[model samples]
Target chain A: MQTHSYTSRRELETYHFHPMVAALVPLAFLLLQAFLPKIFPRLLILDLPLVAVIFFAVARRSPIAGTITGTVIGLLQDALTHQPIGVNGIAKAIIGYAASSIGVQVDVENLTTRILMNFVLSWVQSLLLFLIFRYLLGLRDTHLVWLHELVRASLNTAVAIPVFLLLDRVKLRE
Target chain B: MESFFSRFKNQLVLIVILLVQTIALAVQVRRPVEPGHPDAESVRLLRYWASSLMTPAERISTGFGHSVRGGWSSYVGLRNVRAENEALKKQIAEMRLQQAAISEDALEGQRLQKLLDFREHYVASTIAAQVIGTSGSEQSRMLTLNKGYEDGLKTDMAVITPDGIVGKLRLVFPHSSELLLVNDPTSGAGVILESTRIRAILHGSANGRVQITNLTQDSRIKPGEKVITSGGDQVFPRGLAVGVIESIVPDPEHQPYTLITLKPAANLFQLEEVLVITGTQPNLPGDAQQQLAADAEKHAADVSAERLPSIHDGPATEADPSKPTDETAPPANNSTDLVPKPKPALHPDRYSPGTAAPAAELTPGSPRPATDAPAVEPVRKTPVAPETPKEP
Candidate 1:
């Protein structure tokens, strides 16, 4: 078995990313978040995208690519939201990089590890986004977005094991 | 040498891309999809082209997509279509109910306009122009329109809507023009109570009602009294319906005038269109002469300015370069923002400085506002509440 480590930018770029799949789930999360309030009426600030972002960073193991993904998603989010430009972008980038760094440093290559990592990381991401948007950016609309993020993160963590197994095709790989 | 060539090649590509994007963006910005934007011509052209080119498959897909969700909704929405149809039928009935009322309103508006037109038609040779754009500012309500010198619009010419007087012409361009709405803080209308014949000054307000002030307490003022432009100055024809006097009250200073409140007939927001009455028909020959002079003035202004509109809507003012201009008609000094949008079919050659955006010049008629209301009154007036005396 070749114990290969991806260090070059080209190697990273050329790698089998399945960009559509990687980007699609977060977009689905965004769509769900948008429609959920209309359908459910009671659901507010469900941070499904935040959870999906964390999953990309940890499971995908690509900080740079994750940051790029975050930027595009951030732009889309900004279009949907009234927040100032670059606020969401910076928050998303920080979340992506932080999650990627954690995955690299730790020996978290299993289902349980992925789930736990997603749970913890999503909370951190939510806090940072709230802090930046609320305190730094001076947009204190409601405490709901952060709260919904926490609930969504937990929900995401619960499904992490099954989703990772499916996405990574771990069972087939073995 | 090789490195330099490669660098130049990359730089050239970047520059080319930037240049193309800039041109595209400028065109796109000039004619936004919205009404009052300058690029309405483009929007119309695009819509026409798109409508013609749309494939049968695409139309099918769109129709299918809409009905699919309705058909498969969790409740089996198709099953409830009959009840849904009933609700829609009820709505249709209400709409039918309102249709007569609306048509009556339209008829009234037409009559009012015709009356004003009959009077104005003989004045400055008025060209009927539509109000195409409105400045978004609440304090200085200005309207940009699609007619100007090309359409025989001139400064000080009267503009009016179906409801009542809009405002006099302020600035003129070849293809577009700007009018100061009557509600601006700077706006003052010479008006009189049609019922009492007591002359009172009607002023516009922040909230959407006109207030008549400076009336003596001795003067009897009551609600439902008709107010009209006094026409003492002979500028506004007398007996034009301004609004009814809503109330009367005593002032602590014992000011003689009661605060008479009136509502304008025109719902400012609902007006997608307006008419510019440019004086009378006999004035047309003189109007043509003055238009020549204005064109000359614009030419001089263009020569002194650093640049002019990059694109041409039409060759309406192609000979303007030869016209003589007033050397002293000062070029607009160091404007903080960009020039008004390039007006096409409206003014074709007009430029409203600082009031309109680049996009306004290109679009003639904006779509009706997306809101249930067109605008919260294009002109906001405040109803002066009469301070009733407390009976002992």
Candidate 2:
């Protein structure tokens, strides 16, 4: 059996990524999110952008960086959609910040922690989107089906596992 | 101030980001890009830049995927080619017989329409475009087309497949356009039931279902009834197949209104190529000259048939002057009261050569020529008439 060490906040290590990796990884995810479902519509259940945001935010462990990453990626995702811009931006920015803050407090390097973080944060991201769309934007048609959202978050979590592992190879120990 | 900023830098950044996005959202919500006034410049520019940045990669990926799939399907997937081809040939033969029958009906319809001076809008021109990507959000339900403003696409242009209507162009950038699918929550179309002719507004639900709204429970709508565009909204042409009703249930939110769900006529999820309606022209009398001549010949034969003693004797007994005589009466098979009339010379000002007649002049109950024979001289030949099959 493998053993892991619990690190304190001060001793927790933050990771850096190559500038090309940082930029291109999210772009690739966005492209996949936009185009892949055209071939296999069932792939729509996978939130690739959300997985990317969570992975990068948790890896960096910097709230400001996570917030900015979330904002940029969320706005880009919004631009591809017909809906009013910033709905995804707001949801993701908050999620990014929260994910990073959690990253700082906990040893996110652990497998179980990463899985739980992704699942919970994925659900929270959906909830934030629902609240923002319903309350702030007054999009009365936006209704959240709990079961559908649960499936989405679960699929996102499943995708995040392999995506985070692949991305971790690109992370530079800072 | 510097120390305070340093103490709450992350929180401040988050708040500022959220605030800016909220303000932008408010601006968009306040000044939506309504039809004919798509002047939300900043948002449009942002979307344009984003699409431009992403379009090349999407196009390359889409093209590569298509090439790979085509190669595999063309070369390796030949399991039942002979059987499928034979079946298709049989279907074509059956359809040819049906086409002959339909052609006669169409000619009769044209004669009646000319008699009443009825005009209708038809798809005049279309641009074929490839579906490259999607909005990637279930809530938005938009498609990204490879063609754009440079391809002569504009907002609100109807996008359709041979099977049925797909959507309308929502945003046109330089090299790409966004198509708001009919199943998007924000999308709506004017539709009518085929059998009952009950008109209603079609709406898209949040769960990506197309539905008809604003009908009471007492409405005689049934599942499997076909729905078609009414052309009242001016987006889609009249009689274009929209979808068929899948199910009907009472609306829980809106009292007394039934929620009628529709199964889209087009395979919206599997769309690869679609035709954008670039232009439409009103169906005019001179547009169907070939049909008119054929109908005129048929009417002459019918008159000759009616003059026979056995066939003419039955209606001659009750022949009132107000009713049509044997010479003017339609064929025995046709039940329409409209008599084929000789077409009058089109007004030079209203239907000049190389010009289209005004649609308003052909409204129902409009003044029509008094002649009852279906013979008319061709005024002008349209190079690309609506009846002509276009190669996409």
Name the runs in model 1 displaced over 4 angstroms: A1-44, A60-76, A79-82, A107-111, A140-149, A158-161, A170-174, B1-65, B70-392
Off by over 4 Å in 2: A1-12, B36-39, B76-82, B115-117, B284-392
DockQ of each: 0.10, 0.73
Please compute the TM-score of chain B alone for each predicted structure, in the order given.
0.39, 0.73
TM-score of chain A of each: 0.71, 0.92
Per-residue lDDT for A4-78 in model 2, tens only? 343545244788899999999999999999999899877877778888888899888899999999999999999
lDDT of every predicted structure (CA atoms): 0.53, 0.84
B96-127 per-residue lDDT for model 2 (tens digits) = 77865676676777678789897768788899
Q: At residue B381, what lDDT does model 1 achieve?
A: 60
What's the true lDDT of residue A58 in model 1? 59
Q: In terms of TM-score, how similar is model 2 to the real structure?
A: 0.81
i-RMS for every candidate (Å) is 13.8, 0.9
Q: Where is model 2 chain B poorest over a 10-residue stretch in terms of lDDT?
A: B348-357
Predicted model 2 interface RMSD: 0.9
CA error at residue B344 for candidate 2, angstroms: 32
